[model samples]
Target: MREFLVEITTTIPEGTEPAEVDRRRAAEAVRAKELAATGNLLRLWRPVGELRSIGVWRAGDEDELHEKVLGTLPLRSWMTLTVTPLESHPNDPGKADAAG
Candidate 1:
């Protein structure tokens, strides 16, 4: 599976009810955990003092990544998202070094 980097920032509209924000946040957390467990989501991180989040995900291609992954987010509508496809590094820590 190819990896993609996804960056998201919430865009909850003005005048939105607090209860709705809470509801979507709860669902978002649950969905994140579910995706992580399934290996669709590889890792997630939030920068200090920032409301944005970045996640690494595995998918066959951009279309599938959107349809099966990003499209399934509970908070998709409230989010401003950026997706970038990733290339695996030969020296990535997760893999052993190749011999000459």
Candidate 2:
């Protein structure tokens, strides 16, 4: 499986009520579980900087990732989305140099 980073950006429309936000949050939790069950969930980080939430996922390909994201309604509606492949990192801490 290939790894991907999925970014989600939420836009709150003018006059969007607090209850609506709460409802969307609840719905996102359900959608998260669905994504996890499909073996696509890796990690999700809520925005702490310029970008929105970052989600690491595993999928057969970009198409499958797009399908999964698009198929979920509230999530699709709330955020602008972007996906990029996670490249292999030779310097990854998990793969230390044997010579060391």
Model 1 scores a C-alpha lDDT of 0.89
Local error of candidate 2 at residue 3 (angstroms): 1.0
lDDT of 1 by residue, 1-100 (tens): 8999999998889999999999999998899898888899999999999999998999899999899988898899888989999997877876654332
Model 2 regions lying over 4 Å from their true place: 49-51, 95-100
Q: What is the lDDT of residue 60 in candidate 2?
A: 82
Model 1 TM-score relative to the real fold: 0.90
Please give the range of 10 consecutive residues that has the lowest summed lDDT in model 2.
68-77
Angstrom error of the Cα, residue 63, model 2: value is 1.2
Q: Where in model 1 is the C-alpha error above 4 Å?
A: 97-100
Backbone clashes, candidate 1: 0
Clashing pairs in 2: none
TM-scores vs. true structure, each candidate: 0.90, 0.74
